[model samples]
Target: MPSVFSALPGAVLDDSGLLHLGSPLVEQRRLAAGEAIAPLGDRAVIAVPGEDRLSWLDSLTSQALTRLDPGVGTELLVLDPQGHVEHAASVVDDGETAWLITDRGDAEGLLAWLRKMRFRLRVDPRAADDEFAVVGGTRSALARVVPATPAGRPLVWIDPWPDVSPGGYGYAAVDPHPGADRDWAEAIVTRDEERRIADAAAAGDLVLAGLTAVDALRVAAWRPRWTTDVDERALPHELDWMRTAVHLDKGCYRGQETVAKVHNLGHPPRRLVALQLDGSDSVLPVHGAAVRVGDESVGTVTSAALHYEEGPIALAIVRRSVAVDAVLTVDTSDGVISAAQEVVVPPDAGRTANIPRMPRLSRRASAQ
Candidate 1:
């Protein structure tokens, strides 16, 4: 299905069948001014309804969501038995239903899994993508276009990135991170509301942005997304996702043992890094581009974007052994572009487990 944003003039939809406004700089400025909104075609909705929805979800995912307040936002990650991320969702609950916003490609599989887990539980899981369209922007931008519900509140899921939420950890070195200034939120609008919002933007009554603009801003924020950033072997630690997604003290769930073991005993085998690409050459490395150091492949680019403020930048996952000060290069079809590493997750990032050392017995005493 065509995205609602497609109705706007000069909107260029991307291969994922999503909309892009064709100009990053203009869109970025609009976003900063809270005058821009993007149709999140890549995102879908899942409705979990029933008396046990919150508790059941709490027992199943990485985040502690049982106490999620009404209309409050949170996120969840489903990890495999091996501690690899399987699915991720942005979560919000309206008094009666838990709304899960996830990647469109993962919605079906996620819904199927939820259904299988519904045995004897009071939760009813079903896909609600057709009913709701996700529109992302700052809270103010959404208010300008989307109408409020009968209760006078528009449904919005606030993004909790780069912050150390309860039971979470911040791995970034710098304070007042760029994400702190990014007032990113996604509002769930009805299909008619989406069309109305698009029509308003097209008629110049409101400003509109595309997915590329959102991607560029997200890259700058060091936000780890599921579509481009995740792979079969990806772990939350590598992407520094624990800042918002993982709760270290959360009760046992699938992959909890590995999460605890890795945090306390082992460092993640790979670490995520932000790359300042040398902009001498006008080439942007596509996703999955190889990252190399001294002719050896050490990592792969998960995402790359030409920011409105920052020039060419990228996020890459490299072997944890890679030096923080290493001058790397990204292999693009145009040529190799020099990249300077900015650490997201440090090589030694992990918890210090409390284990009392046993007192040693002297050999002389044993002989006596």
Candidate 2:
């Protein structure tokens, strides 16, 4: 179904929904100031309802979910056996069901995996995208626009990024993390409500931001996203995701061993960095654009945007050995552009354990 947001004047939509509305910069300002909301058409919802839902999910993901409280928002990651991220979701339980909000492209795969893993468990996970749409903005902005409460509790997921969640670890060492001021949340609304919100936007009663403005704010906040930042070999450590997603003391899951080993004794092979791109050429590098150190390719740009306050900014995953102070270049369609690196995950991000060293004995002393 075509998004009702496309009905607004100057709105341009892609396969997902509203990409922009002609004035992305202005939209960004309004959105950040709590005067606008963005329709998250690229996000999908999954409803997991059953007697054993929380415990079943607790056994399958990175977060400790067995005791998840009603209306509290958290995130979880499903990993491959090797600890590579396979799926990620924002979770909120309404005392009866756990709602999983994930990327639209990942919804089918995640649902299939959940169904396949339900071995006589009471949980039933089903796609809820047809019934609900996601809307994102500041907490206050959403409060002004009431969200759906089909079960008598507002369906909202508050982001926990840049904070060390209970049983979770943090890798970023910067004081006052860039995401500290990000007051973001997502609300699940009925399809009828989505149309009504769009109508209000069309009538100038409500302000609407687009995905472009949303991405800009996200990049500025140093937020990692599932669709844009994750790759086949991506790990929570590499993306500084330990701050919110991985529970260091959680019970065993598919990738728990690797997650523990990396944090305690080994370093992740890659590290995430924020890039302040040179905007002289006015071209933003696309995803997979090579990040270079001198002439050597060191990484690939994951997400890039023209932020309202920061100009051109991007997030990239680079080899762990890359110098934090390295002046890098990014290959764009227009040309190669210079970028300065701001470390998100340091090269020494792992090996958090304090193992004691054993004394070595000399051969002569051992003979005695």
**Top TM-score model:** 2
Q: Which lDDT value does model 2 have at 7?
A: 70
Per-residue CA lDDT of model 2 for 22-89, tens digit only, reads: 99999999999999899999999999999999999999999999999999999999999999999999
Candidate RMSDs in order: 9.9, 9.2
Count of backbone clashes for each model? Answer: 0, 0
After TM-score superposition, the amount by which residue 18's alpha carbon in candidate 2 deviates from its true location, in angstroms, is 0.6
RMSD of 1: 9.9
After superposing candidate 2 on the true structure, give the runs of residues whose Cα lies further than 4 Å from its correct spot.
352-368
Error of 2 at 198 (Å): 0.6
What's the lDDT for all of these models?
A: 0.82, 0.88
Could you tell me the lDDT of residue 334 within candidate 2? 84
